[model samples]
Target: MTTAVLEFPGGRLTLNRPGTDDPSLRAWSSADELLLQEAFEHLAIAPDSRVLVVDDQYGALTLGLSPFSPDVVADSAQLGSALALNAALNPACAAPERVFSWLQPPVGTYDLILLKIPRETDYLDWLLRWSNGALKQAGVILAAGMIKHLPDRSVDVFARTVNVEKVSRAVKKARLITCSQGEASLDNWPGIWKGYDLEAPGARVNAMPAVFAREKLDIGTRLMLPHLKPAIESCRPCARVLDLACGNGVLGLSVLAIRADIEMTFSDVSSQAVLSARSNVETAYPDAKASFLHADGISGEQALFDRILLNPPFHEGGVVGDHIALRLFEQAAQNLSDTGRLIMVGNRHLGYHKSLRRYFSQVRQLDANPKFVVFEAWRG
Candidate 1:
């Protein structure tokens, strides 16, 4: 892959992909670099001050701000991996020890925050909550994105919560919004909510704006969810289970309710989804043992599990593609215990059956609706 040197305010960045054939589909948009440069030029970042970065794709902002005490936060496992790889490529900058998982911000207050407005509104709402909680009394918040991507309501959202100032356009493509502490109170912000009911009694899945199918259950997941009956005649004793690509965690939480013995792990590529799923789990099963992580499927940890459930995302950023789903299946196969089962719900057009058959000895159709299909494959 070709390396591009990006000249910025503090220093120059050497960016490149790992492999020649599999090039980066996207580069740090001009807006991303402009936002970082403008923030550094305008804001006085204290050397000892804590800095938080939200939705930093592939560590661009995080790496650019390496001189400061920057904590990188992201919901996508793929982005996280890319950050690590990029950090390794540029060894001069210190590698961040703690990357906060999706929707889970670090506990302490921060002096400054750099945010890239995400596509999901629910995710943005959740971040707003974090902003309310973590920003110091006089802390500064700066967010930027391409003008086209910035929603009309985004300005209203910032204005209602904090005092905001829009910076003059730098590259003609992006604009920066700087915010400061205001009289607005956190009590007013309604967290992202999407109305959906899980099969489990009393389990509701309301997603933040950024998650896929935030308004309701995705047709694919909805199709597969009904077929998730206990594999054993009676529910098996609690075991380790995972909900990969766990948008709102409807699937895992439902499983947790039925089999009280299972320890559930919910992971997704969206921080908002992680936050919503975490809240749903707490609301539905207060005493249940579970962990919520913002990850790209199963790439981060190697925890073996008895059962893995997934409603894997087939598209990347709404573009119809199969790379993400294929990666999820491959990772599931690699992570499952010898006797573990990977059960997934996917769109029928995606042809997940062929993918599952490649990894598992047996793959069977659990159920199907007109638009989606559920498949169960056991790891050999």
Candidate 2:
């Protein structure tokens, strides 16, 4: 893979994606360019003014507007690392004081707010609600995205919380959404939803807006649960378990609920997902020994586990691919004990068995449904 560079008016930024090793996917999209340009044009900030930037994919918008010292919020730790590294490479721009997650956005009203449209409607709604109170009465909010992702509902989220001004015409298939302050406050931002899965009727799963399968048990995870129970039951006492790319942490949490003798580790690339998992696990099993990791699929982890559970993500930044899943498989193989097993669920069409064969010595199908399949593999 080749290094991807973003050449803007003042400086150039070299960036690499956070999770996968693929360098081709590191290139900045048209939406990032449009947003940076529009922010430079319509959004103004004095050096002392407070500005907020939400969901900056890389350092493009954050570094582009470095003069203002805007507060940048991103969910990916790897993206945050990239921003810091890029800022060091390009001295003209300074990295934000601290990279913030949605769980901990900057406080106080701002003079300008910029958002790159997110894929999840709930996340977009939650951001708009936060912006409603964070923006000064005279402040302006600019949102930009690829036309393919910028839906009417995305704009309506702003309309519901703030006053939509006018959307800019498409520029290279990218558009900008501009809005003004409204009377709405952040009092009613959607909080966590509590529910019990069919398998774990006694354990409550708490989900936030940004987490996958926020409302209920997803079919893939549901299918994997039954297969996990028997394997977990047969494991030696005090076995260590890892829930790689754990979304809501339901897989690990449910398993812990059933057997209290296991030590569980919940990991994911998304900070919001990690936060949700930590909260749910703590709330449901306060005394359970669980570690929550916000990482790129156990890239930096040194500990090995007796069992690894996965519902690997195949998509990145709205584009679907198998590179991420394959990377996770490699890490799982390295992080498993000699006698450990890797249990995973994936869409039948993904054909992950071929990839599993590359890492594990033995791969066996444990269960399958019309849409999903569960497999267990030994590390050997």
Candidate 3:
């Protein structure tokens, strides 16, 4: 992929978004530029300043402020890959001192904290709580996001944990939020909720703030659960199963509820999602053969599976499209055994039936409701 240059007043660096082939998808957004302009031209960031950049999207916020050698904290494994790619392309840019989890708050106080405001409400609240705890009493925070994507209650959330100083006027449909250290204290920001209980499709589930369907099972996953038993019948004893893009481990947990013979693997891009899934599975089926991975889809997975369950995400952060699902289909095809099959649930409008044919010889409709469709794709 070709690289694009992000040129600010004081520095310039090359960046690339590695997950897609679309030419129009640039690594950085208007909010990234606006944040850098506000930080360099207006605010003060000394050479020796302690900084932490969170949820950098691609590499804009971190790379744009590379001079100060800011520490990196984000939930997405893809973000870590993006930072590595962009840093290598721009060799002069200093690497982050520590690439860590947002759940694991920084060791010491920071002079400045930069983040791209998240869309999830509970997650945002958690971010603010930990951020406030790590921020110096007089430290500053610059949170940026696209105006269309920014939730109306986001500033209200920031207000709960931090002192909302000001909001920038929309520039190129993007806005930046400024904040000072708040009085709110952190409460189980990174750990699983002791009493988080919810009814999933066929089992109980517990999820963190950022996980998809944390409070309850979504209609799509619920619609897909009844079809899982039929798919498992063909599997031999102790067959391996994979739950791609598994959120909160509900799908795999549901499968485990039926039978404990199969070894289940759950993988997702979000750190919190994986941790939540791990806790849910370990708590319910203490001896069930299960593994959780924080990954970009099935990127490094080489093990062949008898059955692959997927409810692929159509959106990445603020952007929505079918590209994410399409990519997962390709990976699933490569990893499925010759006679193995893939069972998937998705919105009916996504029309995955036709897309599945690209990787599999036969695409059979197992079940369907008004809004969702379950498909089984396998080699003839």
TM-score of each: 0.82, 0.90, 0.92
Q: For each candidate, what is the lDDT?
A: 0.73, 0.79, 0.81
Arranged by lDDT with the best first, the candidates are 3, 2, 1
Query: On residues 228-312, what C-alpha lDDT tens digit does candidate 1 reach at each position?
Result: 6655213346677888888778888778767777888988877778888889888888899999876666764657887888887
- At residue 122, candidate 1 shows an lDDT of 51
Residue lDDT tens for model 2, 1-380: 33577876545776655555566576467888877776666544344567788888767788888877888877776667778767776787889778887557677888889888877777777667777788988888887888887644776677777798888888888888788987766575445344445446366677777788887888899888878788889888989999988878989987897789898999887888888889888878889989888886776546789999999887777768777788888888888888899999998888988889999989999999988889999866
Ranking by TM-score: 3, 2, 1
**Higher-lDDT candidate of 2 and 3:** 3
Best by TM-score: 3
* Model 3: residue 312 alpha-carbon error in angstroms: 0.5
Cα miss at 221, model 3 (Å)? 0.7
lDDT of 2 at 341: 95
The alpha-carbon lDDT assigned to residue 141 of candidate 1 equals 82
Clashing pairs in 3: none
In each prediction, how many residue pairs overlap at the backbone (N, C-alpha, C within less than 3 A)?
7, 0, 0
At residue 243, what lDDT does model 2 achieve?
A: 92
